[model samples]
Target: MEYYEVLENFGQLALACVLGGMIGYERQSRRKSAGLRTNILVCLGSCLIMMMSYEIYKQVEGMTNADPARLGAQVVSGIGFLGAGAIMKEGVSVTGLTTAACLWVVACVGLAVGAGFYIEAIMTTILVVIVVGVLSHFELKKSTRAGVLQLTVYSDNNPEQLSIITSCLDDLHIDITKIKMREEYARNEREQTIILVMEMMLLNSRHYSTTHIVNILQDLPGIHGIELR
Candidate 1:
């Protein structure tokens, strides 16, 4: 390798490291999973891979059969698995989607820096820090008002009570997406105790707490029992 080429490659590696550190620091300060060391290693690894590819390209006068975008594109697709691993679903609530997205962005930043797109990498890193570290709190605050409610009702004597209950829920402006009964058993009888389960998607879901709903149903004419899960 020529002396100047070696120096230029070293400069690319150094700058990639420094920029990665800057972004990682911001995320680490917030105690994110993909913090300093993780980002640093990613940046270093991408730099090495690109440097190798650049050398191969140089050998062919920048006319190699191998594509420059090959490795970078793979990095993006592979990073999706990491992002999916980060996201978690728990009983009508999902978490870590944004964190997972941040991790993906980190990989992109590393690739950009490795490919000598310093300005774009640095700008994207700053935006990512702001998006993940700064904006997350507000998004969380906004989401505090969001919640999900599940309900099941049993009635024995009054068959018409089903309409009443549904109407009441409608009056409350609650959105009901699905209503199913006899899903657990083969029998459907009007005189027999019937189960009514409501699957609802709600926003600003604080208006009716599950406990509060239970309390309200206690005195209703035909209510047998209520379950929330």
Candidate 2:
């Protein structure tokens, strides 16, 4: 290869590093298994393979039928194994799927850079960052806002009290997953008291703290005490 051609190829490789590193930085910031170094290596390797394929085709010219795409095509299929490694099943939820997808996309971006499709590679990197970085932020915010709560409410033996408590919970978008109630006689008081134990899930718990819930229930006519776990 001529000196200028080799310099151009090196330039392409450098671009691949930059594009891959952009994605890697996001993954690293989030503490993903495949972080900055892994993504950059994957992109750099794929780019080198594509460049080698092209060089091989040039050397053999018309000797036999040497296809530049043959080696590059293997990258697409071979990347699946690496992607699969990123996936994990934890209990009922599966994680790292997005990381696996990011690896695959990063490899493609590398191939584009190797093939001199600079615009395509840059654009793909931007879109992938938006999908994994920006979109993931919103997804995590929504998910973390939900939480489970266990509450024990002490109130007078009034049927209307239970109704009032549930009404308040409903207004706050709290779902009662499980509930138990029992009647008990107070040591100092002659009237019967109701002990309500409930397991609740909040759709947006961040909006309502445990103290806030307790304060709301304390204002009810029959409620005497509240405990939250």
**Clashes in candidate 2: how many?**
0
**Off by more than 4 A, model 2:** 144-229
Using Cα atoms with residue i matched to residue i, what is each candidate's TM-score against the true structure?
0.61, 0.64
| Per-prediction backbone clash count | 0, 0
Candidate 2, which ten residues in sequence have the lowest lDDT sum? 193-202
Q: Give me the candidate number with maximum TM-score.
A: 2
Give the alpha carbon lDDT tens digit for every residue of 1-229 in model 2. Answer: 5999979988999999999999999999999999999999999999999989988998899967789988889998999999999998642236788999999999999999998899999999999999998997886676565765677777877767677987988888876544566666565467544454333334545567878877987898877677775
Which is the leading candidate under lDDT?
2
Please report how far candidate 2 places residue 107 from its true position, in Å.
0.5
* Clash pairs (backbone) in predicted model 2: none
Please, what are the lDDT tens digits per residue for candidate 1 over residues 37-124?
A: 7777777777677667666666766454667777777877887887787677643446667667776777777788778888998898
